[model samples]
Target: MKNTMAEDKIVADKTIATKVIEKLREDIINNRFETGSRITIKEISERYGVSPMPVREAFRTLEGEHLLEINPYKGATVLRIDEQFVRDVYGVLRALECLLYETALDEIDQGVIQKLRCINEQIRAIVDLPYGAAEYVDLNTKFHSTIMEHSKNQKALEMYTHYHEIISTIRKKYIPVPERIRTGIEQHEKLIEALEKKDVLLVKMAVDEHIKSALENFMTQFSQGK
Candidate 1:
């Protein structure tokens, strides 16, 4: 009975920690919390209506994810992000994405190719709708993942998934830029054409150009302090 009770406690603590981690991650990514601002267990617990222990545990996890900077005396502060951060993350993403495209194209069937087209259309349909940014981002991610899903490089796929967590929030910030959307959708069309032709060179080039455009857009936003 004592062992069971201990197990239950462990599970409960884990659950609380997970919830706290998720909340903190979203708030941090959305810039709801001030970057470089210090946070403490007591204060975060009070605001989140959770206990101090789980908040403490969540801090460790966020720190591992590079979203938090924890110190012995200063407690924790939100990690500051800048253009270099964007360039580094997107740069790694570009290489992985291009490789995924190279490996995935030969195996991708017409059905998946059609699905990509439909997703691109879905992305293009909402350029004028400001509320659609989140949905647009989702569709865009789906469009890429649908293709990457075909790649046989399990290791690269795993790495891309890990890296995407860092890039995904950064991406959502730039989706509201209409030019990015317009250019992205056009590039997606070009990408699909390349895929159909089995032109690996064109596909890789398209991936490079697409990611570069996104990097440029992200840099533009970061410079404007938005």
Candidate 2:
């Protein structure tokens, strides 16, 4: 009976900790926590109506994800975004996407192509809206994911999904400019057209150029301290 009771207690603690971690992650992704702002265990514990133990456990997990940093004197502060981090993550993401595109080229069907075109049209229509940047990010994710989903290599698909999630988190704080959005849509159109032509080289080039343009634009903003 004591062993069972102890097991239940452990499970309960884990459940609470997991909940705290997820909530905190969502909050951070939504920009509720500013870059370099401090997060306190006591504050989180109070907000979640839980003891500090679970909050601390969640903090450790967030730290591992590079979303939080724990200082002995200062407790926890949200990590500042860095150029290297953006470059590295985006670099890996681009490579994974290109690989998936190549592997899945033959597998992409007309229905999926139409779906991507539909998504692009939605993106173009929203360009004038104030909140279109976020919507574009989401639709763009779906557009790429639709193609990446056709990859027969499960491991590549998984890696692309993982990198894309991190990219999504990064994007939450960014709102692309109208020019960038317009250029991005054009690139997407080019990619779709290339795919329709069944030109392998053109498809690969379009994908590479699209990623390059995005990376350059992001780097330019990061350098300007935007």
Candidate 3:
């Protein structure tokens, strides 16, 4: 009976901890908490209507994900993102994404191109909506993932997925900025055009430029502390 009771308690704690993690992650990504701001277990527990244990578990998880920092004396704080961090994250993305695109190029067909076009259209449709930034970002991810799926390289795909998750929070942080959305749409169009022409070199060049431009824009935003 004691063993069963302990197991149940563990399960209950895990369930609450999972909920806390999800809510905190969303709030952090959505910029509800400012960078470098301290977050305490008591505050999160009261805010989310959970006990301190669950909030503490969630903090450990977030710290592992690079979303929060656990200080010895100050509790958990949102990590301060810098220009170098932006460059490094995006640089890894560009490297992985370019390799995926190149490997997937010849395997791409008319149907894949059509699918990408539809996703691009969906992205454009949501860009101007008041609450559409998240949806827009999701659709954009789908568009790129579609092309990358053809790579058939399990290791590359896994690496890309990890990198994607890391940068996704960054995207959520800046989702309210419209210029990035607009520029992404333009770059997508160019990439699709290159694919239609069956010009692999052109596709590579376009992707290179797109990633460089995105890095520049992201760094510009980070430097301005926006």
Instruction: Choose 2 or 3, whichever is better by lDDT.
Output: 2
Arrange candidates by TM-score, descending: 1, 2, 3
Across 54-164, the per-residue lDDT of candidate 2 in tens digits comes to 889989988876779998766799876578777888888878877888788888878878998999999999998988888888888888888878887889888777666
**Best candidate, lDDT-wise?**
1
Q: How far is candidate 3 from the true structure (C-alpha RMSD, Å)?
A: 7.5
Clashing pairs in 1: none
Report lDDT per candidate.
0.81, 0.79, 0.78
* Candidate 3 lDDT score at position 15: 77
Per-residue CA lDDT of model 1 for 1-226, tens digit only, reads: 1122222232344588776776677678777778988888887777777789988998998897778989886789899777777788888889999898899988988998899999998888888787667777788889999999999898999888867877776665554577788899999999999999999999989999999998887788777866
| lDDT of model number 2 | 0.79
Of 1 and 2, the candidate ranking higher by TM-score? 1
Worst 10 residues of 3 by lDDT: 1-10
Give the higher-TM-score candidate: 2 or 3.
Answer: 2
Each model's total of backbone clashes = 0, 0, 0
Which candidate do you rate higher for TM-score, 1 or 3? 1
Off by over 4 Å in 3: 1-80
| Candidate 3 structure quality by residue, lDDT tens digits, 63-170 | 876779898767898976566766787888888877888788888899999999999888888888897777876787788989988996779889888667767766
